[model samples]
Target: MVNGTNTSGFGYDSSTHSVIAEPAVWDSYIQVHKEAGKWRNKIFPHYEDLCIIFGKDRAQGNKAKDFAQMEEDANNEEQSEQIEGGFEEQTTENEDSPNIGSKKRKKVDDVIKGITIAANLL
Candidate 1:
């Protein structure tokens, strides 16, 4: 019954032997692990969100896969260009236009496709 720093049965018993924990010490451990479980969820929907936004038909196209690949390729190309040229190049079609953030800028995927089409023309 002693709950202070030390005393009888709780700490030193009548024989002064330190008894270990008893069996069935915790009868309810599961409830502690589930605390705030529902509050923890992904901040952003997986690639599926992008697919829906792009209006892709699940039965026909895998847009999430395509986008992941495209983004990977664009990143690799950028790194290679930076190393070969000492720095990556930036092109602006109009100087007087308003400055926009990076995401607002035209994607390099479109630029690459345009270059591919122009190369076939020549």
Candidate 2:
């Protein structure tokens, strides 16, 4: 009872009386669905409404924390650069000064003593 050359299990194109492959049927279905409306056209308004209702506080808090952390990191980096520059200047000056070795040894001893005191306090 079937038409000519339509023995394939895929969709039958009645006009052409030929069997459409599964992939072709799916492609045509998707094409028709897309022509009806875009996927986002159905969901964008709901997404926007949800963001407006729920995103404000969480977004602002995260942004504030991130900005603060960035500023703190920048300040720490700047201070470290200044400290390194100061040490370089000190070494250059100390090269011309008398008792350069003694001066550096005394500074090292002072730092060690400060660390010892801090350890004792802890």
TM-score of each: 0.21, 0.26
lDDT of each: 0.42, 0.54
Question: lDDT by residue for model 1 over 35-58, one digit each (tens)?
Answer: 533323213224334546655343
Q: Stretches of candidate 1 above 4 Å error?
A: 1-52, 56-67, 87-122
lDDT of 2 by residue, 45-99 (tens): 2543454566646556544556457656756776686578558757776677756
TM-score: which candidate is best?
Answer: 2
For candidate 2, what is the lDDT?
0.54
Give the deviation of candidate 1 from the true structure as CA RMSD: 20.9
Task: Quote the lDDT for 71 in model 1.
Answer: 63
Cα error, candidate 2, residue 118 (Å)? 36
Estimate the TM-score for candidate 2. 0.26
Error of 1 at 17 (Å): 72
